[model samples]
Target: MVHVSIHSGLLCSNAAVVRSFGLAPKYEWFDTPEPSGKNEVLVDVLAAGLHPRVRSQADGSHYTRPRALPLIPGIDGVGRMANGQLVYFVAPDTSLGTFAEKAVVDLRRSVPLPETVDPVRIAAAMNPAMSSWVALRRRVDFQPGQKILVLGATGNAGQMAVQIAKLLRASQVIGAGRDSDRLKALLALGADEIVSLADEPERVAKRLGEAASEVDIVLDYLWGQPAERAMLAILTQRSDRSRKLSWVQIGSIAGPTAAVPSVALRAANFHVLGSGQGSVSTANYVAELPALVDAIAADKLQVNAVPFPLSEVETVWHALSDIKERVVFVPTQ
Candidate 1:
């Protein structure tokens, strides 16, 4: 097999503290490895997204440790193989990652891409957008025209959840977040109502309870104080406790743990479930990518993406640090 020369954003060999990726050299050039198995295909990378999970994985703070030292830093990307089939793929767990000019992915894990969609945009939005898309469609069996609530609606994933919930034809979409200004921005993004987590616990609970009275589904990105308040609110204020309500836990941005009143769960009709790695199977997850990408391409789903060349990861590292917008590395550029 002939090897191809390529560039990649490689993580340092040793574990180190990186305050800003600007100072940490993460990109390098190396020969691409050939696809080793029948199930694998080599891809000419187009774009790779820089996400909080990527950053954490690079820094060794994520739940899943780094694949290996001197490894590439992207978990997912959009690329095309020599056969000319454009696809969006999740990189296998290996040192060679999607940040490279070339990557190897299992064929089963790859989803065919539509020509109507811009590869870079979908590459940037897919990971964040997957949470709600999967949660509502698969985990919760969400119904169209139902009322939904987004607990952490200001962040990238939360914001996408708001749009996805509306795109799914939810009759009402309520957004709640810590920042008042950011929460207000969600109203234009499809949130029918907005609640602030900045208020006192009692006040936040009251507001959330009022909203929960009509909500059929709750997409929770924050699992700490806000979730505690919202859960309590549901327990105390749900007009009809018998009404079906599904609370899908997608992220733990606020904190890893939440103190919940055991009585709340035992008494309320609300169902609490989680969505992500283990909850949703790989085949089901891959199956939904096409529709999610289609939604993005059609402009039904909106997101903020900042693109940078693979060689300029250091220069745009600070920008990537901002969770409000997604920063993508375009290797072809």
Candidate 2:
């Protein structure tokens, strides 16, 4: 059985959970009934992703408390609502796990999908798209001709940020990631330059400085010492031209926290900003999801999703937290 719900008890199905440490959670049967409330709808889960939040919550480090024991873990699902509409929904709570046959979800959190959109692709893209969209809107404010740098640029949200930057008229979009091949591959999506963050700390910092000197904005995902040092080195170097900076910090997949220099911020006149979902009001997000879908339909957006079968969820879940590509888990039976 598969899904997430706001209310308890929909016709029951077997769901999985992380029952103990170092071992995968096995499935157990549960009961569920049809949706009875005005704002709730039961959906047949078709696809979902093993997103970082899901993985962290499962691992007990997501900055939030773990769900109740015997938790059915899933936060995103593409499914059919009770009214028989094709939809995608984000369920951030673990009260109702998604690895079951079905669950009731709040109607407000669901987004109806286009007929042609693949369930797995939509499921994979939704969370990262929202994260990237919010990040771009709140963190990076680049003028049309401004140069922008995206660290961890190969990941799903990073690639989306690059596309969004170009869409919003960034003058130059430079993407730096772990893999040179992946960086090169992203150029088709409007990355003006691609560099590997593979060198030693000093070399990496110096290389980043030279690659995109006098950067106007940066969408950074890495949060460890290397990223922090590189950012400082790029901002602190002497130059006749003044470099006003804006940094939007979103994911810290690289490290828990960064060691930033307050002096560097002053020297560069940097405007460091945060781009997390915490700032986006739920109402506003609800209103914007339609527009976001339209933008995707119009080819004005792109997400680098790596599709895999639902059976490999644990494998994919672990990979999601790594500095890896965007993922889309399919019920590819």
* Highest-TM-score candidate: 1
Candidate 2: count the clashes.
Answer: 12
lDDT per residue, candidate 1, 1-333, as tens digits? Answer: 123333344322211123333345355555565688999987778888987778766666666655356556778999988888888998886656777777888988888887666888988899999999999989987889999999889888899999999999999999999888889999899999998888788988898887767788989999987787788786677777777778888888988888877877677777888898778988899889889878887888887887877877766765555545788888752
lDDT of 1: 0.79
TM-score of 1: 0.88
Per-candidate local distance difference test:
0.79, 0.70
Candidate 2 residues 48-125, lDDT tens each? 766766666666566654646656667777888667688877764545656656766778877788778767667666
Report clash pairs, candidate 1.
Answer: none
Residue 54 displacement (Å), model 2: 1.8
lDDT for 281 (candidate 2): 65
